[model samples]
Target: MSVPALEARGLVKQFGALLATDDVSFTIQAGARQALIGPNGAGKTTLINLLTGVVEPTEGQVLLQDHNVTALSSSQRVRLGLSRTFQINQLFPHLTPAESLGLAISERNGSGADFWRVAGTRPAIVAEIEELLTRFGLEGEMDQPTRKLPYGKQRLLEIALALATRPRVLLLDEPAAGVPEEERQDILAALSALPADVAILLIEHDMDLVFTFATRISVLVAGRLLTEGEPEEIAADERVRAVYLGEDAG
Candidate 1:
């Protein structure tokens, strides 16, 4: 079998007396469209942090393409083809989308200080930036300062910026959060069209988005791997229905 794009092995995260993640284990195969869903404060954030190396795990390991990355910092992981977008937009308000993409792409090439210079020296990079902007529906917003764009556009920019890193695995945390109803479909379309080679793990609360985008689903409840399966299986699970689907368990 091909190696998984990302894997978690018996992960556990504890804070004082609270067990945030409890012995969870799972894998995201290359080219997979996976969703991680759960209730509020269900340790989803903690698990994402552990996977991305934002926090050290109290126990267990994270492997990227079967290589141990449990000891690496988040930035180090990003350098190794791991990238993530936030639940809230993380963007530079002053930079245009094109400039932001240039900066991220330049940073990927170790030219973090010279985004414009990189674009000047490399037409290929400029083309790439333009293409990504178009793909994420930000082409029209490209030249405008990020802060001036609508919230949905800002969310798209954040995802575009993550893609700018050329990641093999992408973690998306609530990509549609705070987006207006009218713009939500655009976000859904953009997400549905992501590069197939880049495995994605979506951490989201939007059931419509989750069911629409995921081929596989992993349910996290109180920091544990309650279950993982195809979307249909997950939707039909009695336990999942009880805890998540708002259906009567009986």
Candidate 2:
């Protein structure tokens, strides 16, 4: 059998007496578009933290391409093809999109310390930055400082930075949270253009984008895996509607 792109097995997290994640287990098949959805305080963020090595699990393991990465640090995991974006934007406020993405690509290449030489002297890296900016619809804003860009564009640029790492499994935490409706299509389009082999585990509350983008959906409730199925099955599930998605979710 082929190994999954990412997996969480019997994961648990606790803070004093609060159980943030409870025995959460799931798999993201290679190249799958999977959505994780639940009401607020459902432990979605905790789970993502555990998966990305931002926090250690009280119990269980995180696997990347069949290798155990439970003990790895976030940077080590990124080197192993695991990368994620945050609920809030994590971009260099002072840097332009091109400069930021160049830094990311350079870091992943283990040559970030040599930026002065690499940024201008490396044709390949320059080409890659241009490609990423164009791919994420940031070509027009490439020279503007990230703080100067609109919220939607900043969100897109953050995702672009994640992509610059060339991850095999990408965990996106609310990529559309603060983006306005008019600009959401830009985010969606960029996401749709991701390479087919890059598995995306999306944590989002926007039902429209969720339903339209994910082939499969996993519903969490109070830090536990409530149910998982195809988008249609999840949409029709009464339990899901009552606990999370509204009755009119479909």
**Which runs in model 1 stand beyond 4 Å of their true positions?**
113-120, 247-250
Per-candidate clashes come to 0, 0
Q: Model 1 Cα displacement at 10 (Å)?
A: 1.0
| Tens-digit lDDT string for candidate 2 (72-167) | 999999999999999999889998898999888988988878835747468888999989888888899999989999999999887999999999
Candidate 2 — which residues are off by over 4 angstroms? Answer: 115-118, 247-250
lDDT of 1: 0.91
Clashing pairs in model 2? none
lDDT of each: 0.91, 0.92
Clashes of 2: 0
Sequence-dependent TM-score of model 2:
0.96
lDDT per residue, candidate 1, 1-250, as tens digits? 9999999999999999999999999999998999999988889888988999999999999999999999999999999999999997889999899999988888798877763553636887888898998899888988998999989899999899999999999999999999999999989989988998999999998898999999999999988889999999998898898898873233
Q: What is the C-alpha RMSD of each candidate to the true structure, in Å?
A: 2.0, 1.5
